[model samples]
Target: MSYDDLMAMRPGVTFDARGEAQVLVWAPKAEKLQLQFGEEAKMLDMEPKDYGFWTLQTRALWPGDRYRFLLDGKGPYPDPATLYQPEGVHGPSEAFDLQEYEWSDRNWKNPSMKDYIIYELHTGTFTEEGTFAAVEAKLDHLVELGVNAIELMPVSQFAGDRNWGYDGVFPYSTQNSYGGPAMLQQLVDACHEKGIAVILDMVYNHLGPEGNTLGHFGHYFTDKYHTPWGDAINFDDAWSDAVRHYFVQNALMWFRDFHIDALRLDAVHAIKDFSPVHILQEIRQQVDALVRETGREHYLIVEMDLNDTRFVKPIEAGGYGMHAQWVDEFHHALRVSSGQERNGYYVDFDGVASLGKSFRDAYVFDGLYSDHRKRKFGIKADGIPGQQFIVFSQNHDHIGNRMLGERTSQLVSFEMQKLLAGTVFVSPFVPLLFMGEEWAEPNPFQYFVSHTEEELAEAVRKGRKSEFAAFHLEGEAPDPMAVSTFENSKLQWALIDQPPHGTMLQYYRQWIVLRKSQQLLRECDRNGLSVEVFGEKELLCIQRVWGRQHLVAFLNFSKSSQEVSLPFEHLSWHKLMASSDSAWNGPLEMPEQAEAGALTVAAESITVYANIINS
Candidate 1:
């Protein structure tokens, strides 16, 4: 194959016009390479090419045939670009063809980032079967919840069956335990049929430790730079061109093959690349090329800890062309406001005032001094739009990383949960929800892993314990390796039929409906909203005005009722919905106020009103 042909798609199993399977691999370090295929384990010598690439073709290879490459005759390792691993990550790589699956979502156009209400869920905990088909069966619940986009946690092939999906060795292959690529394709088709876009979470900074043998092939890792996981990927070192191409092809494969609408790049801050053209920009350029070719909108969303707006800015503006990035400041501020224990990163946030700043500025720590960091952190995002930041009250890291793995419902009052949901939905930025948060699922989303090696499992446990020693919580954290820990994390789907759980679901549904119905909320313009904090009363007031629609939301974080005076008494503000209303199963107590035009906000509740006079 020519260089142009190699650049077109990821190098993997492909059938030629003669119906023979051909494979290409890059192994510059290897003096010799061989391939073993089929149940008979037939070995074939790979022809060395000029560009440090090895190629081989065989008529015996079938769709389900398993193969592995022998590098320098040391050992046979799984193909790095394998499409399907029918067995676990350590097992032989199975041959797969993208042409095998008949996709029905040809006309699917991705929803705009501004219009996305993303619901992030782990497939294992999302349903009882823990398969992609199982998730597809539950699509109706997401559609009814008003989420136009579903961000799935990483589904790549990891070490074991029960994992959070972060310890994935095969980036291109779907988790075999989750029904592999075929079931995933069916799920994407089902999601599109229900008008919900799919966003896949991809980890590119480092591959998992176990069952990963990329270093055996070439210099895929660099000792020049370091990451929390281990050695960083070689993006700017010698023999780095093929390494870059490998990951870029991974990104393109997800979009072009699976029809994934967007990719949520996991922990981009750790991607140490000093090249003139960043890996992110190259990804953006290629994705744009794909969009032009297919006439489908695709997005690249990143999760970075820095308060840098360059990722979301356009490429021509000397910034990475990322459609959006996760903004964790909103979550921290909201959690602190609701009386969460101030420790770790939460020490920097100062309750209601921080929450208010997130509403108006979208980036709370934009060049502001952080007490926790003991220095000024974050670049000022002066003119960034609200849609560029994705905010959520609860996500996998928020709940699962906790020592006790307690959800927001477990940490705060039921009314506070409602208030949190209202604050997220009413905000100008996009809102994301963790699985089972709508019905206040009592199950804790504890982090769980099922690595086959006992030594690695013990190391993970010790590391987790040492990390949480600073928090100084009461009891010991749950055992991440235990089956009970994984089982306990599953969402109780039947809880929505119960009393308080069902009522909380209704309250969440109302907020979602209101957010979609009101143009003021959907505008996602930073200039359209104003936020005020009444520190003494632990109250926040968010005022939004768009065209003839004027809306005001009063959020009370205190344990007692607080009355906030209306900003403009001249405008007749009619009550739209109060989370403390009886219909939502709140106490429904009407607090007595001495002054007129004072809005009584219930304890740990959110109250919104519309200006009827403006209309």
Candidate 2:
């Protein structure tokens, strides 16, 4: 499709078939607007259109041309909707044709949500090269691990060479340090070729402080509703239609231009919009239309702190109609149950019972009193399917936000790590794994940023230290601006060839394969699951039944071995997998069959049993 047809002919730089370029920009504050093209510094006056949009037709622009907008005889600035910022965020934007690059996976279809085993990773830290090309080199490893989707952390252009990607300034442009837009397109194409979907995480709640020129051009943000990062985006105020369209168009461009299969919105709880049609709902509706037009399966996942099912509920039922959301209660419950140091939000969850509760019900804080917030938190998610909530034992925020940036491997024993993996993979909800989590890479996923401005860099360092003060952690917090910090976070890929790492990798592969093969394990029915906890013995039992198909898991959270009575004594069961099995290089041997009696579970181990007769 043509650029105009793909982007709905929005206001931006567009080239016509007659070899003329059309420049359209929204700059209501500028009484006069001029476009500077090429090395000759050729300037052209643009005519003012309705709704503060300026348009001009000129032969001075081409497909590979460079241009900038001059407002009221002022200095030149990059286009707000620039698709390619080859240089850093402050440099001039490059004009490029989206149709230049070719795609091979034209018939690529996204896997269903129930089959999504998302692997979340940062492009800068995932590989030694820290580029999109480098990530493509490792697609074979993800395919071997059996994850269907790869959820990339934010890749939008930030201020400098290094960042967590949450501090993006230009939402449309891919990070220049990570090989820019063309490289990102290549990565997406590679993922689809391997039958894997690419889910890009985006930050729309607030823009980064540095290199942000949106306010200079228009009222893109509002001081009325404040976010933790800064002022929230203007979504429900006067002249907010333009601000909302800017983001909505960005979302569409990712799918149409880059062919991204899914979008994982970062922290939608911070997005304060009280409009008649909420921004979340608006994006979903527009994306749904695009899915029909392109005949592709697209998903919208939001990272919302509030345990509100309204975000995932259908629009006909008065909700946002999103596909899924990142639910943290499972992580919190799992961490606490595994005997991690409790502080901050960890204080709210009870140990084994809470973990069992999270497995049965998606949220542990559903309409319950929260000691952390001193209020009744979360609404009841009774009818929501288990697949609508994405659960993980460890993620970027769960590990990187720690004072020392420790993974579950660093905090727990090897056996407990195996148990943690079993619990997450066997659960009904969609499971996500961090980049190096499969083989247990020892490197910590620390928060690191490289800012050119000294003042902004130091402010970030101080803020990092102060935020971790509540944990009362020992030693000093890592300096985020230091280059060594970023280097330390890189995954050691060679470790996978070693002893324990190789065994752990096989264990993860086994569990993921088991989840996909078993009918009861793959079922997304929330009401079909039951959880029984022996709080005194530190043992948790989960039974998932769909019709006559039964899959049961026994998890022993204690340090010592425990004997647990089988709840389903009437049925004959056969062992499917166990964390303590000899195949996993563990000392214990799994019994071939259990005949309705007491079973001894090893210390910090998880065992799965299936009914002998299938429905």
Each candidate: how many clashes?
A: 0, 0
TM-scores vs. true structure, each candidate: 0.97, 0.97
What is the per-residue lDDT of model 2 for residues 484-546, given as tens digits with 9 covering 90 to 100? 999999999999989899999999999889878887777777887888999988889988888
Q: Tell me how many residue pairs clash in candidate 1.
A: 0
> Which 10 consecutive residues of model 1 have the lowest summed lDDT?
587-596
Per-candidate local distance difference test = 0.87, 0.87
Model 2 error, position 139 (Å): 0.7
Residue 133, model 1, lDDT: 89
